[model samples]
Target: MYSQQVIDHFNNPRNQGRMENPDGVGKVGNPVCGDVMYIYIKVKDDVIQDISWETMGCAAAIATSSMISELAKGKTLDEAEKITRGDVADALQGLPSVKMHCSNLAADGLRKAIEDYRNRRGMA
Candidate 1:
């Protein structure tokens, strides 16, 4: 089962698709569950000006992806780096235990993307 917001997000995820000239990009997946997620970010002056994601998973995955994108937008690299799986899960309210990995996946995607950005810009 899923929350109303999760269902809504799953059906109409915000910040879906991709970003052109993204400052950073991350791709991660859980092979056991076959859930894959990718995150794209566009940053300026160390601030995340835009974010987007693409995921191939269940409702929880979709919800987490959408929520992460929203949370990452307007955040600085340092701010976004501090975001954790608990933050993603709390943002979505709650998720099925089996689907908890989706939240972690989202967080990992964001973190990796930010790290990629930092490495590219010599900020890491």
Candidate 2:
């Protein structure tokens, strides 16, 4: 079961596409569930000027990706690093117990992307 916010986000998700040439990118998934999330970020001056995602999963995955994009945008690397699955779930109000993993995956995607950026920039 999905929440209203989750349905709304799934029906019309924000930042739902790919970036042409992103500064960083991350991919995560659960093969068993066929859930995959990819996050792209465009950073400037250690700040996430833009963020986007593309996912193949259920409503919760879509919602989490949208919320993660919203949370990461305009945030500094440090700020983005603090984003957690709980924050994503709370942003969507909440998710079904079974779908909680989707939120976790979204956070993983974003965090991995940030780490990729840091590594590329020799910050890691």
**Top-lDDT candidate index:** 2
| TM accuracy, model 2 | 0.94
Pairs clashing in candidate 1?
Answer: none
Which candidate ranks first by TM-score, i.e. highest?
Answer: 2
- Tell me the TM-score of each prediction against the true structure: 0.93, 0.94
List clashing residue pairs in candidate 2.
Answer: none
Error of 2 at 39 (Å): 0.1
Candidate 1's residue-wise lDDT over 1-124, tens digit each?
Answer: 7888788888889999978889999888966777889999999999999999989888888899999999989999899989988888888787888778644589999999998998998978
Measured over all alpha carbons after superposition, the RMSD of each candidate to the real structure, in angstroms, is: 1.4, 1.2
Residue 1 accuracy (lDDT) in model 1: 77
Count clashes in each candidate, considering only residues at least 3 apart in sequence or on different chains: 0, 0
lDDT of 1: 0.87
